[model samples]
Target chain A: MSLLRLALANLFASWLTSVVNVLLLALGTASIAILLLANAQLSSALSRNAAGIDLVIGAKGSPLQLVLAGVYHADVPPGNISSAEIERWQGHPRIASAIPLSLGDSFRGFRVIGTVPAFASLYDAQIADGRIWRRPFEAVIGSRMAAVTGLAVGDSFAGVHGLSDDGERHEESRYQIVGVFESTNTVLDGLIVTSTESVWLMHSRHAAESAPHQDGVASHDHEAVQHDHEAKAHAHEAKQQERDQGQLHNSVIRHGDDITLLLIEFSSPIAALTLPREINAETNLQAASPPYEITRLLQIVGVGLNWLNAFAGSLVIGAALSIFAALYASLRARRHDLAVMRCLGATRGELFNLLFVEGLLLTIAGIGVGLAFAHGGIELLSVWWGKGQAISVSGWIWAESEYVLVFGLLLAGAVAAMLPAWQAYSADVARTLSAP
Target chain B: MTAEKNRVLQVEDLEFHYDQPLINIAKFDVARHECVGLIGPSGCGKTTFIHLIAGLLQPIRGHIQINGVDLSQLSERETDRLRGRYMGVVFQRLHLIPSVSVIDNLLLAQRFSRTKVDRSYAVNLLEELGIAALKEKKPSQLSQGQAQRVAIARSLAHRPALVVADEPTSALDDGNAADAMRLMRTLTAHADAGLVIVTHDQRVRREVDRVVNLGDVA
Candidate 1:
């Protein structure tokens, strides 16, 4: 038997204490590893979803909510902005491109976004089957959406009124799945894309059916009144009828002649410098920078994560302390045993190494168990969050700071072992052997 | 070297004191393959003398030469190496590492000495001691007599030039004590190594070729 084997055997002799040390250290390691994986995934997901998009302009509300909803598809949109306002922003010479998103509907909890093809191109999404939506009722499903809903090309499903599966279904408007986009590893993967007119037409038909009297007046007035005074009276009545129609549409659709938000890219750096301030200051719409808002969100989350990390750090310290106590106690109880070893042929350094090897072995076992726990937790989370998309968090891609953590734990273990090892090294062999 | 050429152990004016004199010897020597018994009453420093000769304790003013090397002239590490290579010790307490099996305890000597482990030789030594079947057993599982025999086997596993056994049979009955002494003497004689046994039991004196009574030396 080698020194390491002897050390291992001795550790197993007091298996309960070793197990306690292993468990505490494993828990600490698992927490740290999980924290790193989650932080990395969150940062990557945020950056990927927010890339190439400079500003999100939506109805006045929380800027964070706007980015979370419009950019990440994770929350309800703050409110909707008018299509006229979106077109006005699109026409600005300083704007490179503006993509208007018409939301407020979902199928199986996956959002149905009404947008032009530019929205798909923004995320580098390509249709993997059939073709893009070319008509009001035709829809293109993202790869994740198709996999989750089991809706392939040529399948048809009705949209739900709100951005959740339990919302009221619009049974009158059946949208046929015309295509499915390939996986883009972005928020776009969880969307159903249709034309803006589809949302408007579906809600407009509901409005017309619920308020037939309003439509009757506009149609009937056009058939009468030939004289100038009569024509003026008819025109006035029509204007009032049109105003009534606008109110009915707004009440039914929630956003009158409007899209949910505008995704804006600046043609010049000057637009980034000037636009958000001007828009938030001058218009009813709120303009938000995606990168800034996401950073603020992460900073808020980092506070709690820091506290969790502190708790894990304390556990690691406790593990090391436990190792020290166990070794010291064992060394005290095994004084004669060590003296015997010395008598047999072991030097002081060899005895010291025996104890050191035990500590190192415990730490290594704890790390292995902790890594397994972390990876298993991440795998479960990935399966839940990404569903059928299989977002994997598997790798040894540790951050530089994580390397410091690993080395620091090893150092702590070594330092913990060193004290008892020194005692073993300098033990009075003759006195110990002579003792009863 | 010339003076120590035929002696496995030699001592000259050995003295050890801890606030007072615990041991004092004017001269002592053991020739190769000789069995020497050290006899003393309690508190007479028989164990102390053994420790001094084994280099576990440094003498205040003396020379302890084992296998032609002076123990006082060597560093702690050098002395440990020399002891591991040339001297084997059996403590009175039979201090076997309780966590390991008997065979592993035997192998531990080879491991610490950085010598090649020979399982066949260890097995043969255990068979000679009549504890071969108990090699796989832990020290805690063995009887008092059996554990003492295992400790003896471990000490001699490296086949040292000198074997120092301290009260190896103190806990045994008369019959068991005689058997242990005979086994120790036979094994050391067969290996052609000198043996130093420190004991107060008068029954052990008959088994040794010479007796050094610490009462006379101190």
Candidate 2:
């Protein structure tokens, strides 16, 4: 008989066991694939966000934490840094533009950051509807936040006290949604952006209620409302006048010198070198170069994660070895079959081919099944993740390296079958035929 | 036997062993169209001697020539070629390839022999062996006698020069064994192949041209 036919017969002789082995290998491969894919995407997002800014000036804390929380939206900021201290660095020749950030709130597990109009513009954030926030308490929702929370323009939602799902609620300081930002495949997908004044207003309201301080403050009742309305009207007129005059300084700073983090951009690369260190040593604040901090963090975490991947890879190798052992053990049971072929004048090389064909069949079946499983799983994850982001990937996410991995696995199978093939080759034809 | 005509198999000083040596036949030969019946008690080397002659085992002190080629000095590939070209085998237990259809079992001889298969001949042999309807059936689906007949058909399909039957009737009833032996001897003589059957059963011994008791030779 042809060696291929013989191999097929042997593989199917224990059909259930062969199927189970393929399934096991596929599961292990798919698990590693999903983990690696997620890690690659997350790392890419972090580096992409870090690419836009030169330095992050914030309250002195872990620079890595600040970069992660501020740029990538992965974690919380280290601590609140005073905007008053940040404002001093704004007009310096070394600093081109100093954008402020105010954090410490969330809407349904998504962080709410209060930033200037420049924040949206710098990030190229487009609005699906309505305009930017022009007053305190007005907010803009991210595409992912809106999709998940179902919050639209003119809807009001209260900010929770923490980043987690079970954080306390600040129901008293509910924010108004004035705009919805279009989908951008960045951290904005899971963030809430508004004016810095809105965050300061929320915190100030809490402070005023607790302390009941009135000295040097505007009237708290009807007169305060009336005066604030007049101030807003005057500010609007001043903006129109500045537009006509061709000088853009009429924009009002409602909460001056108060921000949690500052995203800075310098006019030149040389400014980045001296400006960050100067800011760190000259002021009580700390400045972090996002790219550097991110790379360092990646190096540290990447080393640990890569080590884990290697360990997982070795486990997969162990699975392959077990498969080899199982196939080899089956050779003894198949000796009689081999003998029949031998007496028919089947060559030793053909006998070896029979075993190799069996191994190839197992490897291909395992990879095929595993790929299907991984595709289905990745689709499910995409549905869940797309509810919070705009990134999409294909079902058959075959990379150049993945094919190499599969080839390597198939080669290992061949190597595993070699021993049994050699045994079959060296088997005594007469002895087996003579063996009852 | 004639000096050089129709001689299919020859052996000289053929020596074989198990854990301990026993029968040591000095000379053995079979010509084409001849039927040789080998009779011996249990553990008397009937099976071992057939195995050595089939090139399945190497005799320590002699040579085996099948179709005029020395099997002892041949490489594995050469021996396999020699076996496929000149010899067919039917064992006591009927070693039919279990996973394949009966026809495939017959075709296996052709495939490994690397020869053009005669499907009609295989079918005709199966019909003569009383398993014509079982061509597509697996060995597991066959009765013991039916399986044994199929094994014989497989051996003769390639039209080899020598056919070795190692206890082909061991598991059969008296009538079935007699029928099997008569059918095999008639098929071998018709194909002009030398038939060498190893069996201890005296009931089927009378059908062959000659019967040699291995115990008498030893």
- Residue-level lDDT of model 1, residues B74-114, one tens digit each, is 99999888888888888887788999999999888877766
Best-performing candidate as measured by TM-score = 1
For residue A256, give model 2's deviation from the true position in Å: 4.1
- DockQ of all predictions against the true structure, Cα-based: 0.75, 0.56
lDDT of 1 by residue, A313-338 (tens): 88888888888998899999888889
* Candidate 1 regions with alpha-carbon error over 4 angstroms: A84-95, A213-257, A267-271, A282-284, A381-402, B1-3
TM-score of chain B of 2: 0.94
TM-score of 2: 0.77
| Error of model 2, residue A274, in angstroms | 5.5
lDDT of 2 by residue, A1-436 (tens): 5667766777777888788778766766776666566566666666556556888888787888778767777667766666565556687787878888877777777888878787877668899988777766678888888888888999998886557656656688788888999977677767888766566565555444434344323221112121122333334444433443442221345433346688888877799779877878987778888888877877888888787678757756765776687678877887888887777788888888888788778877776776677667877878766676534444556544567667777787678777887888888766665555
Residue B195 of model 2 has an lDDT of 93
After aligning candidate 2 to the native by TM-score, how far in Å is the CA of B40 from where it should be? 4.0
Here, model 1's chain A TM-score works out at 0.82
Model 2 over residues B17-108: C-alpha lDDT tens digits?
76788658876778888888989889888877876776777777888889778888898788888898789999887889887889988888
